[model samples]
Target chain A: MTALQLDTKPNWFMANWQQLAGFGLPVLAIAIYIGDDIVEGGARLFLQRLFDGLDNGAIYAVVAVALVLIFKATTLINFAQGELAMFGSFLAYVGAVTLGLDDVKVGPIPLGLLLSIVVAMVISAAIGAGIERVLIRPFDPSDHLPVVLITLGLFLILNSLAAFVWNVNPREFPSLFPARNESGAQNFVEIAGARLFYDVIGTYIVLAAIGLALYFILQRTKIGLAFRAVSSNTESARLVGVRVGRVLGFGWALASAFGTLGGALVAPKLFLKPDMMALLLIFSFAAATVGGLDSLIGAIVGGLSIGLIQSVLVGYLGDNDSAFIILSLAVAFVVILGVLWTKPAGLFGTSAVERV
Target chain B: MKAGSDLAASPEALWSEVEAAADAGWPQWVRTLNRTVLVAAGLLLLILPFLVESIALRRNASLLVLSLGVLGLVVATGKAGLISLGHGAFVGLGAFAMGAFVDLVGLPYPLALTASFVTCCLFGWLLGLIALRVKGIYLALITMGLAVVFPSVAKRFPSITGGTSGRPIENTLDAPAWTGLTDSQTIAVRYYFCLVVCIAVFALTRNLLRGRIGRAMQAVRDGETAAAAFGVSIVRLKAGAFGYSAGLAGTAGALQVVLFPFVSHEQFNVFLSFRLYAAAVLGGIGAIIGAIYGVIAIVIVPTLNDIAGGLIRNDGRGLLDNDVIVFGVGLILLTFVSPDGFAGLVQRVGRRFSNRP
Candidate 1:
């Protein structure tokens, strides 16, 4: 490791110089290109792109939260976060669709979907705990290489295990949120002459609720304090009588639950499959990277920003065979590189001082 | 125990015995033994396609070629501790270079391969320069992003790379007309071509590692500040490793065109990098000879999956169902149980047989 340098937090505006341009340059370029297209394509297409971007952004943020959870705890990127979530979604799928849990009802409301989600989340939590205990705890967690390798191994295992269990085919998942309102019409609320989807609205509400719940758990709760202590200094926290092992397990569990929930929500729209979240995982990495790796709030904002840029840029690129497919990801990667080059610590990351 | 005691008694006795046994000189005899083994292996490989009688089995060319790419990875990640998760980009760069030089520039096969090597070396050097600015996990992330970017980068240049479809080399070098080889034999010629390249690169890497640059790389990997204090230009040495590794990868990629006949945008996905990583880890990374073991594991993995799948099920599923999962399990288990990997395992075996400490 390079010699660690200490730094007082600089003003956001001061730190923003490189990153602002890193993000803004691409935004400006995309905007100019989109502005050119809007003159010909008009408002409806633009609105659709915005809505799509928001929807994608919301999902990316949700997953990025999961990423931030682990990063906070271990400072290591879990390559299998998506796979683990995909596994959780697969579990939910099994409980709801394969086993017909959705057939059950609690009075007028069907509790089956809710039941499946609860069951899957619990199982996913356990899976996460097991993974940390079995695969991670033994290794030197400070070294990212081993942990990354382990997570990659987990990625492969979970991905192929899902394939083995579910078969390598896409399965339809019921949406947690309804697309239509009570009136049987596609739910839309008009804002600035642009219609918003109820599904999209419901997604936002669910994500916001999750966000609030996370905020409460991280801020207000006792376990959250324990988690923070453990994350900051595992040995010192242990010395101070914190149950570091259990706290680490809890963090992993929470992260996995978030991942599973993110997957369940996304699977409905993208269709449930082992590889469905693979590419999204890459985008989520970008989001996590774009945001400071350690900051939860930064992750959310980064996710939303990346999601918007991706959708808008892709939309602007148009469907020229696989051009959008390749270019969108290429552009995202470039953003990551640009950020790394300009601001190694990231936008919201604690900039460690470099003492020569 | 008695034999061991005899060895403990005198180094002179053993040395004298070895000296007496040598027909030429001690060094010449060892060289002779090495040459003999090489010649025998080469002959066996040359005749393999004829004996196998299956073009599908001959697809081990891909394995050999991929192993060469993994060797490049070892140079960066293992020897230099650079942690490049994006070696596929180097491989892809090389593959595309081969296509451009051979098809576009109309170069001969050898010259085209050299051009591909030189191209990947340049890119690797640039990435290494970036490595100087960033260290540790950050570098890994950057490389990972590069791995993801590579396919699209290749696809963007439709004229050069044939978009997603990829370009195939025309007028491939074939077996001599004198040999009167069959179709499979012609394919086997490609396999031999890969094997020769693999051997050359392996020897080259071995020699580099045995020399001054290799020590400097290891020093840089161990401690950058200390290396700089010792007057080693961290940038030059590190970038040189990157260049060399990428050159190896490029060489592999060039060979891949000969073996596979085409290169696609999809061919050099991030998964390729991961697989190379897995191979390196499994084969005991940083050691050049372990590359063969790594590639062997890679090639044999599918077969193991097939055997398992065949015994377990004969339904509508593919023969190698969830093979990747098995590899995943192998990776996890191998890391936990035998972190040193197959090279360490081999050393243990050799030690056990020889009864050496």
Candidate 2:
């Protein structure tokens, strides 16, 4: 019996082949790229690419989750989600740069940064909820085209509004996690000969904290339960005494806040323009689809993989140029089409059943 | 005695005559009225250039081109219930394809126009075939993704596409000397060229929509399973819808260069697609008149600004400042007030007046 067990293949591998394939493929691609350079000159470049992937992935994940939030609540993809978040980032610009909050400080924190963050979040939450109440609630929710069109209309309105306000010129959004003035404090920590900046580390930590807060609020709170109940089944939740309409409003508000924060995080890197989140929105849409539209964790996985895949493709297959960006998008478009054709439910989403 | 007399009147033949009158014959009065109105409209259109300023006539020609473009969207998004937010690219493809046919392949205007329409239609069919698996929200995203790649691809092929700076087309369409029109009235001749194309294309579209293919599209739009049950090829219908729409858009684009004399990358960007989608919505997706009205909505805005320019600003860009607001808000209001669009409103008013009898 012991001999039979030892000779036999592991059951775990047999049971989790799909998951293993999922993780294995990426690892194999990386290994193939960095073959025989585990400790050589390739290590630093690899590490740097990996870090960049994570940074890009983190931003994509947030935006993807923002999309997932609205999808969860209404089963409608918000085309305007990016624009709404861009609006929030604009609010941040207004609070910090326009309002002179960046110049002042409250103790250790810069007053402008703090004020922008808090105000932008609060106002964004309100705007998101108000939009659901006023604009979305009025439309027939079951028809997908009308809702999508509505969001698209909002996209135009919000985008042009931002441009009208800011004059279409690019503005530098001051980084929230500004590097310390001292050169010694700003020193990069070398990891496997790759230099990691403090901003990247700080950003990762901040994202984690935000994610943690979201997870708890969604998984552990009373309002979270109401939100989930409505998302799962609005009419059924209403039968159970939950205010379905209010939950939807709250759901939208939360989604907008999340998207706003995501846009804010990316604002500095994107240089704050009306079209700042436009390309990122496409990537996030792809990420959301690949991860499974209904799954939160799927969004994160999708983002990270997209980021990694894109960085790797650019590094190996193409150079950093407009043409290369087009190539990357084309590849992403293919991936989306493939996933849609084969597995419409995505990797983690529950398969939707349509009744005739 | 009366019954016997009626029986003598070829009873079977009488019933057949009744059926023919009921279904086939449009009432003579209504037909005559329609012809009269059409004649009047045509006469007015023919003489419109003579009455209006050169700029206004040129704009009218541009409007006609836009109408052709939006007509394609009406078939796809309007008739088939397929939400396409990327038709702007089709317009570009049509324009560029026409340019290529004329300049590179050395074809004349008529052949180039047909080639452009066919090329764009074929593309639409190909993309429609790929999108068979997806439905609803995902379908929209798939189409949007397709739109996103258009500009980049256009930019990549700078040689044929003329890159960022758009290429100028040869002035092949000109007034015949037999018309007694001078060089000063050449713009009127341009208007006539557009009229001929528009009439031919619209007639073709009407014929197609009333036939078996149109019936298939309507069936698919309403209920897919039922249509499939009837042995209708769903893929064919879907592909046909997209292809037809794109074909019309390309035809319009070909004419667009005729009117403007230049085709550029900026003219076919993603935002233009949004504007087209918005135009379809405002025009009433399924109505022919909606396309005309919808194109007019966008075309007339700047004209309105020019009219209101003195009141608002000295620089002549005041109305543009509120363009986004107007378009965005206009779309929302359309959804609320008349989801069927301006054509729907016209139909309602017409009904209300007709009902007074």
Residue-by-residue lDDT tens digits, candidate 2, A1-356: 68778655687667657656655675698677756554454767878877877778788888888898888888999989999999999998899999888888767556678678778988999999999999899877788866876788898889877876676788988777655344657446789888777666766776687678778988999999988888888889999999878888888888888888888888878789988887788888888988988888888888888888776555555555776677777766776776777667788888889876
* lDDT at B177, model 1: 92
> Candidate 1 lDDT, tens digit per residue, A1-356?
33333333355557776667776886787788778777676777778778878888888888988988988888788878999999999999989999998878777445898789889999999999998988898888777777877887898777766776677778889776654445767568877677788778877887798889988998899999998897778889999998877888898999999899889889987899888886787788888878878878888888888878877778777577377667767767766677777776676877766665
Candidate 1 Cα outliers beyond 4 Å, as residue runs:
A1-47, A103-110, A180-184, A319-321, A353-356, B1-47, B54-57, B152-168, B176-180, B318-322, B348-357
The alpha-carbon lDDT assigned to residue B254 of candidate 2 equals: 85
Write the residue-wise lDDT of candidate 2 on B1-357 in tens digits. 123233445534433433343233234443454456456756877788878898888877777677877888888877677788778889889988888887788787788888999999999888788776688788788877767767777876776678878778764566777988776577777677888898888788878876666666765776677556657788888888888898998888888876766777778877778878888788777655567668768776666756764554323334345565566777888887888887666555555555233
Off by over 4 Å in 2: A1-41, A106-111, A179-187, B1-44, B170-189, B308-322, B352-357
Candidate that would win on TM-score: 1
Model 1: what TM-score for its first chain?
Answer: 0.88
Distance from true location, Cα of A321 in model 2, Å: 2.1
At residue B103, candidate 1 shows an lDDT of: 82
Interface root-mean-square deviation (Å) of every model: 2.6, 2.4
